[model samples]
Target: MRLYEFEGKQLLEKAGVPIPKGFYVTYSAMGAVGADPELERIFDELGGREVAVKAQVLAGKRGKAGGIHFADSPEALQQVVEAMVGSELLGETVTGVLIEEKASFEEEYYMSLTYDTVARQPVLAISREGGVDVETFAREHPDKLVLRRFGPIVGLMPWVARDAAAEAGFRGRELRQIAAIAVKLWRVLVDNDARLVEINPLVRTADGLLLALDAAILLDGDARVRHPETNFPPRQATGRPLTERELIAQAIDEGDYRGVAGKYVELDGDIGMLTSGGGGSITLMDAVAAFGGRPANYTEYGGNPPAEKVYRLTKVVATKPGLHGLLIAGGIANNTRVDVTFEGIARALEEIRPEYPIVIRRAGPGEEEGLRLMRELAQRLGLDMEVYGADLPMTESARIIVEKAAAYRQKVEGK
Candidate 1:
């Protein structure tokens, strides 16, 4: 789960990290004319000072996309805020704006505390170069990036923070302040079960006070039960807001923990994909695209999900519009029963009877029975379906589906 900038800043403030004074103004609050008296009062409360109007969307690169605007006066701020409230930023609708006091910073630094999956440990990365393109800078000047890895047991020690800050070119009092912020940030990560806590442009003002100019926090979705107090809305993997179907899929998964049947992401394509296994799903998606197949959605169901769960998931996938074909392929499963998965898919097929060509390549436990069930159902319903097993490569199955979908399209187009 990714928290919005304002939410992340609130967490930072609570963790004792200094952030600029800001308040969020929703689109509804801005009114249609953006002439709400409350907005004017908010500007006045900030002493009519120079402020920044930042669009509060989930995606990044907002600055490059004109989502971040600077205002020297209340009128300019209101204009900027109003302009952003209704616009779209990075494919997400701008529903709110974070109006924050603009600060004069003498220097900007980069800092992030995140879990390094490869190392399986908490890592603190700091760099003197900070801004919107910190990533590009890091890639170009790897030496400037200071990294410190902390053990799971010891966590991020104060000494480690000091060492990282020193390496990032901090000195004396400023180094101590940076180290303190690092500790607080580590605490934020641990206390919130966060996967990443990043503060770009940890700026130092002319007065020598360090403050976070921008914040981003991503919590571990699986660990949500650990932090029952945090109420964040569901979001897609791309960080865009979830679609209605995606939300429904989430609810379906949450309702039953019997099997891992909840990995569904809607994409802009014509082929509906039902794949399994993490690596397998990725490979299939790439293969489908490589073969000129535009996948409508990505779905994974394994661990032998029940018939009802599979039925619901298949129903969701089969009903997606613009679907020219359906590809059901997966890696050879260890425990997931093929028959059970097919039963659910067959049930959904019996109901929806999608005209698109369907391809299946499932080979695992109860493989014969599963393939038989799918074959019988397709024959009984007079559906255009092709079944495969481990004998044929998954990528080959993807190619067949692409060809079949193309043939169907040509036939439909009457060309």
Candidate 2:
């Protein structure tokens, strides 16, 4: 979950990080900001000072895109807001603007607490130079950027934070101030289970106070169950609106921690897939494509998920209107009960009575019973299907499905 600037600011404020005071001007206030009494009254509360009108879009690099506009007074602010409210920025329509008091800062610095994959731990990064992309700045001026890795359990302590700030060239009161803010950022990360909490351009105002001018946050999608107050809309990994099947697949394992049956990404193709295992899913996708089977979606369910989860996932995958075949395949499971999992899948097929050819290639504990269950389902339904165990390699399973699906399509089309 990547929060909008206003939402990130809310979290920062709650954690005691000084941020430019701002209010969200929703698109509903686009033409009404200056003329409408209510909207105009809100602007008056900014004390008629210089303000920054920022487009509220998930797209990045707002500064270069004319998404951030400046105004010295209320009339100017209204005009800026009017121009921004409905404009398109980086392919995303601006839905609103975050109006904030523009800070009079002499120097800009960068700071963020981000999850580092290599370290397998969250690391706090700070820089003397700010207001630009941190990665670019670090590359250009590595000496100015400082990084400190912190243990997830111990967190960023006060002493280490102050030292890190000093290392970034801050001294005296400035060092103390930035160090305190750093700890607060760590709190924001841990408390929210966020993978990233960034304040790019941590500015030093003319008054010598530090205020965060911008924010970027990304929460762990898997940890979303722990935060109930959030209502962020579901967005595909590619930032597009999710399809109906994608949404259904996404919600399958919401509250259940038993196993994952909900990792799904919809694709443009005809073959439906229900695969399991971690990296195995990607390998299977590649195998299927290599064999000319266009997987309609990439989905995996494993770790011994309950039958209902698999059953739900099965329905979501198999019922796609244009599927020529359905492939239920995975590596030999280590702990996942194939018999139990297959029961759910078989039950779903019984209900769907799909005309498309189906393939089940799975092997693990209870593999015998599981293969038997699928074979029985095929016989009872008189379905076009093939059931296999570990005797056939996963790649071979993919080839079989592609061959069957292609043949079935030809027969149906009289080609």
Candidate 3:
């Protein structure tokens, strides 16, 4: 789960990390003139200082996309807010804006605490050069990027932070300040069950103080059950709204906990995809797009979902309009029963009776039986379906579906 900027800053403040004084203004608050005396009062309280007007969205790179603005006075602040409140940035509606005091900084730095899967422990990364172009800086100056790994049980220690900061070239009081901020950031990450806690341009002010100029935090969704009090907001798509079919699929996924049957994201495309194995789904999506096939949606089901769950999900995908083809594929399964998945998909196909094109590529414990059942069902329904096993590469299946769907669409349009 991703935290909005304000929410992440709130958590950072709670954990003792310093942040600029700021408040949030929701879109509803920006009504007709004089509708919000409260906003006027907030501006008045700021006393005409330069402020940063930042759009509150889940995705990153907002700075480069004109989502962040500067206002030197109350009137400028109002204008900036008005311009950003209702507009869309990176396909996410700007529901609110963060009004913060702009700081005069002597230098900027980068810091982050995240779990390292390769090391199987938590890691802290810091760099003296930081900003919107931190990626480029890291790529060009890899030695400047300092990383320290800590045992998950022992956690981040103050001495370790100080050492890492010193290694990253911090000196004098700034070293202690950066180390303290790092310690607090680690606390925020652990206390909130976060997968990543990042602060870019952790600025050193002219007054010799350190403050977080920006924050980005991602919590571990799987660990949500442990922290029921934490309220993470819903995430929006990168480019568009969720379709009705996608919403139905979401409800079905949350209805039961039999297996992992969630993360259904809709896209603008004609090919409907039902895939399993998280990594495999990503690979197939890329292949489909690489071969000039537009994938309508991305669905991943694995860990042996129940047949009923598969049936509901498949039905949702099958009912999606403008689909020229359907691809049901996955990696060779270890625990998932191929026959059970085939039965559920067959049930959905029987109901929808799509005549365009269908491709199935699955191989697992019940491979032979599942293939036979699916082939028989396709023949009986007179469906244009082709079934493949482990012998065929997943990318090959993607190409076949794309070609078939294109041919089918041309024929139907001609008719």
Candidate 4:
């Protein structure tokens, strides 16, 4: 779960991180004109400081993409606020703008705590070069990068925090100040069960005060059960709304067995795919696309998904009207019998009996039994089926599906 910028800022503020002063404005209560009075009042309360108008979007690179702007004057600020509110960023609409006082920067730094995939643990990263993409900074200037591993049992200690800042080129007093804040940030990361806590432009003032210019935080949904106070607002997709199936899949992550298993995502293509195994699916998708077939979906039928479950999911995929083909390709897992998956496939073929071209590539445990069942079913129903053996690699299977789909498309277009 990802918290909106405002929510994340609230948490940061509570953790003693100095953030720019800002307030959120909603669309319904006030048109930009109606909100003028309140805005003026806040501006007056702030004693005349330059402000920033930023669109609250989920994705990053907002600044480069014109999602952020500066307004030195009240009129300029109002114009920016008016332009941003109700606008869309990427594919997500902005409900409001974060009106914040601009900070005077003497120096900028980057800091973040994120789960490290390779180590399978949380890692803290810091850099003296700030306000830019952290990944880009890490890649371009490896020497400026400072990384520290955090253990699950002890979490991030004061000594580790000080060392991280020192490694980022901070000296003496500055290192001490930054290190204290880093310790606090670690506490926030752990106590809140956050997946990420990033301050990309942590700034220092001429007077030696440090503050966060921007913040982005991602909550660990798996740990949300423990934190009742955490909240996320409704995220409207910027372009078209998410499909019903996508929303259903998104909602399915509330309990045990909740993670979205299999590689499944919606795409703007003509073939619905249900391939299994990680490497096999990747190989097959690339092959399918390379061979001129546009996949309508990406799915994986994992080792022995319950027959009924697979049948139900297949029925869902079959409902896509634009679907030109279905590809069921994957290397059979050594441990799971192919017959289990075949049972589901057979049931789905009977249940949907979709008119679109269907392609199958099967191999693995119970390969003979699975093929026999598919062949028997095809014969009994008088349905034309294409089932291939696992002797062919995933790429070949994908190419066959793509070629078949292209032929189908040509035939339909000709008709």
Candidate 5:
């Protein structure tokens, strides 16, 4: 949920923070030759010195990825834009570029606000060593990093901001100015329900002007309702764009549900798992680990996912080369048909039919019928599937799968 530089700068300007002038253009238009005729007008009006042509992407580490460049002349600007316009960024093709006036930075400073899940509040971070990555700076030069936690109820206060600036070695008027800006940014975060608002290289010019050289903003998806202007249009995995189904699921942030690609989350011990429901999937993983077995993934079918989606999910889970066994588990179901989950697993197993052992522990509503249906389906498909009754403790079922898989692997490997 990282906003592009243009978007970040727009938000910062509205918050009364100083920012450089910039213009954004998508690559859909023709190349430099076609674009120059129109861009010349702006170049003439703005007596700006250096301009930056930055590639817009959701991913970070853009500098490392060569997504940013500087242009000293108008011709150089056109060359940089032409070279960067249609290029792919880490496999996602560049759709647009942000052209901005570069700042004559004499000194760089860093400031940011991030949510602390454990503290259940926001943490304000600032450093004197600014232009570089904050994490690296904090690690190598820990003394320069100053962090203060704000209470969730009170948000950030002016006094706390002053203290943070003082710790970062700022003095007198400069300290007050930077700290006041920080307080304002924090206020923006609280009002806008932002997960993070960061300004790296908040620069001070030789002429004594403070400005933001770059900004990063991450909006809280849960609080998107509060910010109507920030909604992202739906898109697909190949980044071509998303269909209706992808959009529906993308609304929720789930570690269990990945993009179009297969999702696998490693557990402590050694049991490959496929299950549905976020709460139940996590509990199953914990239970498996608690009993000395590992759940290979945190994957779920999501809300009433269709057969094809389940089949697609299982195909991903069952085919993993590292998996020792499989534990298909779920909680008491009210609306989700047990038969659909069972069928998805059965079909996926039938397709791969790896020698790995599998134990299915499913129940609740349509229990008797679903169990019978899966049993018949497995036998007809010439599959060796272990179906456990609902009464069986989930912990016991996971242990059984682990032991069976171990024995099977050992027998096959002659170990």
Candidate 6:
């Protein structure tokens, strides 16, 4: 969940890090174009004509992608905003443009804080090399990079930060300033559930001030429930926005941690898929596609979650519009109880009462009871459905559902 630049800057400011005076603007790309009157007021508020215009998107290398530009006057600002807002940068749609007072810097530096796998804790990386790629700087000039890993309890003490700055060859004033920033950034990372908080080109202004010239922050997705103020919409793998159903599905597992029922990716097709296990979900998706069935989503539930979690997951997936059929299939489960999981699906079906066809093939502990429960539920609901067990291979069941869904879709469409 990589945040936009303006959002990151907000986090930085709240954590007591110095940043350039700025505000951000967002508008719809498809809407009619015009110079916003608010832009003029913001220009006056900045008390200067010299401003840096930056695109707000998840993509990186924004400068190289022409997402960064300078505007010296009202006319220039309008042109830059029009060119930037409602545009594309680095293949990402630009919905917002940040307008800030440009800085006159004497020197540039880099700073970052993130979880370190090897250290098994949060680590801070700082370097005198600022405007360049930090990874390349660390690799090429390891001597210039200073690394500090912090423990969970007594995290990132001030004196330790100052020592690290001294080790990086900074003298008194610079050492104190950079070390202060280090402490504030640690606060930001911990408080905001930020997986990565970075400042590239952390600058020393002409007035001898340390400031964050750029903010690159990525938030932890699992902790999103704790920070609704961020107001981020769920996004798919390719950056498209998630559907309402997908967002609902994701919220199901929040704070539960018992099992996973939130790994849902909505798709274009119509078959509602309720696959289980780890690799089993993906493998079933391929099987369905291989058999000419179009799955409405890719989702899973495993680790023997309570019936409540599965009921929520089932409700979300089964309720998707244009669902021609529903497929509930998974591999042989070692511990996931079939009766408990199937009861959740049955409960959701009772609420939805869909006329669409359904097929089920799950095998695990209490398989017979689960199958019987599903069969009885379908009969009572008067739904057209079939229940299978371990005897029917998952792939074969996939083929059967594909054929049935196709026939059902054709029948509905009068094709």
| Candidate 3: residue 121 lDDT (0-100) | 90
Q: Would you estimate the TM-scores of all the predictions? A: 0.91, 0.82, 0.88, 0.81, 0.74, 0.72
lDDT of 5 by residue, 1-415 (tens): 5577778888888888898777888876645445585455444444547787789876666778899998877777778877887788876677888887776778999999988888877899988888887777799888888988989787788999999999989998899998889988987687678889999879998788789878888877788776787666543334334433334334433444432223344333456788767777778777777766767666665555556557766776676666778888887766677776566666776778766777888777667877887678667776657887678875577677777877876776896
Candidate 3 lDDT over 320-364, as tens digits, reads: 888899999988988899998778878888899997799999899
- Sort order, TM-score high to low: 1, 3, 2, 4, 5, 6
Worst 10 residues of 4 by lDDT: 254-263
Whole-model lDDT values for every prediction: 0.87, 0.86, 0.87, 0.77, 0.74, 0.88
Q: Which residue segments of model 4 deviate by more than 4 Å? A: 26-49, 72-78, 115-122, 150-152, 233-241, 248-264, 277-280, 290-292, 301-309, 333-352, 363-377, 380-382, 388-396
lDDT of 2: 0.86
lDDT of 6 by residue, 218-335 (tens): 8988988898877766545455556788889889999998878887888999999999997888898999999888899989899988889999999999999999999999999998
Measured with C-alpha atoms, the lDDT of residue 22 in candidate 5 is 78
At residue 332, give the lDDT of candidate 5: 76
TM-score, cand. 2: 0.82
Error of 5 at 292 (Å): 16
Name the top TM-score candidate.
Answer: 1
Model 1 lDDT tens row, 1-415: 8888999998899999999998899877866464667767778777688888899887877788888888877677778887889787888888899988888898988999998889999999998888758778878898999989989787888999999989889898988999999999989998899999999989999999999999989988889998888777665556567888887787777857898877789999989998887788889999999999899998888777898888888888889987889998998889898888888888889999989899999899999999999899889999999999899987899999999999988887885
Residue 270 accuracy (lDDT) in model 4:
94
RMSD of each: 2.3, 3.8, 2.8, 3.9, 5.9, 5.5
Question: With candidate 2 superimposed using the best TM-score fit, by how many Å does residue 98's alpha carbon deviate from the native?
Answer: 1.9
Q: After superposition, how far is residue 290 of candidate 2 from its true place, in Å?
A: 5.0
Task: Report the poorest 10 consecutive residues by lDDT, candidate 2.
Answer: 31-40
Point out where model 2 deviates above 4 Å: 26-34, 70-96, 115-122, 150-159, 171-173, 220-238, 250-260, 289-293, 306-308, 351-355, 379-382, 403-415
Instruction: Kindly list the per-residue Cα lDDT of model 4 for residues 43-75, writing each as its tens digit.
Output: 655556787778877778889989988887666
TM-score of 5: 0.74
Candidate 6 colliding pairs, count: 0
Model 3 vs truth, CA RMSD: 2.8
Taking the tens digit of each residue's C-alpha lDDT, what string does model 2 give over 303-402?
9999999999998988888788888899989999999999999999999999988888889999999999999889998999999899889878888888
